[model samples]
Target: MVWPIDLAVLTLVVMVAIGSLMVKDLLGAAILFGAYSFMMCLLWTVMGAVDVAFTEASVGAGVSTVFFVGAVFRTSRRTRD
Candidate 1:
């Protein structure tokens, strides 16, 4: 690789990851998780791994997030503990 991933984008990814973990609402968590996946895709692209980026975009950012949101909508958002 000629260059490295930008620090700013990496920081944003970390923030989104933390936000996804910290959110109480399942829907909000799903959104943040999608954002995290997108950021990862971006980082992968920046690293010149187009195939990995595409796979992450389609699977992590697209299909998985949709599935998570759908499941979240079907279930109660509140925790049982």
Candidate 2:
């Protein structure tokens, strides 16, 4: 396991996580969440957990992102506040 690569991916995961939370747009947040999940998948792959990584990529990044985007599309784009 290369430490630098792991660290870079880890940093990306953290940044994406924070960006997902900070974004005002729901679709943008969902996209960031997908990116965070993909980064986590890479981390899992680096740790030799191919099965877990596949699950994260399929479920966390793929299905959930689609669900979030679908739900976002059904809602009003204007802010409630």
Candidate whose TM-score is highest: 2
In model 1, which runs have C-alpha deviations exceeding 4 angstroms? 1-5
Deviation (Å) of 33 in candidate 2: 0.5
User: Which lDDT tens digits does candidate 2 get at residues 24-74?
Assistant: 888888899999999999999998899999999999999999998899899
Candidate 2, residue 46: the lDDT equals: 92
Give the Cα error of residue 75 in candidate 2, in Å. Answer: 1.8
Per-residue lDDT of 11 in model 1: 86
Any residue pairs clashing in model 1, and if so which? Answer: none
Give the alpha carbon lDDT tens digit for every residue of 1-81 in model 1: 334456677888999999898888888899999999999999888888999999999999999999999999899676532
TM, every model: 0.87, 0.90
Runs in model 2 lying further than 4 Å from the true structure: 79-81
